[model samples]
Target: MSDASGERQSPAPFLRLVRGNPTPEEAAALVAVLTARARAVQAARDAEAAAPAPRSAWRAPSHPAGGHPPRGAGAWRRSFHPG
Candidate 1:
């Protein structure tokens, strides 16, 4: 049937088949099962979105050249220069 704008639109084939075929009890059961499954999926997505993000373990390294040379600096310099 045509909608407000007068453009004709037909019901989907799967919807027409479902509407025409199922008994009342079967239709109710199907609706209940699908509704429960949709609620479960939405709840799982909400829980995941609310969860906190994990933090990284690494920290920023301290600078070593500001008059506080790093450990083993003397050994490293002597090894490199061989003087």
Candidate 2:
């Protein structure tokens, strides 16, 4: 693209090779490492999102909601009956 001159201009490179001039293999290696890191981070995020939430300590009953009736005759049978 060009300005009023209508001359073709080179597009700016998105990934600039800073500092040392790297060989093609080195650039490919850098890209591979970056991709792997990104994938690992995304996988961790997905696992966290899919994992079941832990029950709150306060919300759960510590022991069975009700215990045996005061140890009297036929109390065992009463235990089975709905509260």
The candidate that achieves the highest TM-score relative to the unseen native structure: 2
What are the runs in model 1 whose C-alpha is more than 4 Å off? 1-20, 59-83
Question: Which residue pairs clash in candidate 2?
Answer: none
Q: Tens digit of lDDT per residue, candidate 1, span 1-83?
A: 88999999987643233346788798788778878999999999999999987654443245433334335758768555654
Which 10-residue span in candidate 1 carries the lowest summed lDDT?
Answer: 58-67
Against the unseen true structure, what C-alpha lDDT does each candidate score? 0.69, 0.80
TM-score of each: 0.48, 0.56
Q: In model 2, which range of ten residues has the least summed lDDT?
A: 62-71
Q: Model 2 Cα displacement at 63 (Å)?
A: 5.2
Tell me the deviation in Å of residue 53 in model 2. Answer: 1.8
Q: Candidate 2 residues 1-83, lDDT tens each? A: 89788988889964667799899999999888888999999999999999999987666766444543556788777778745
- Candidate 2 segments exceeding 4 Å error: 1-14, 63-83
Best by lDDT: 2
Model 2 residue 34 lDDT score: 84
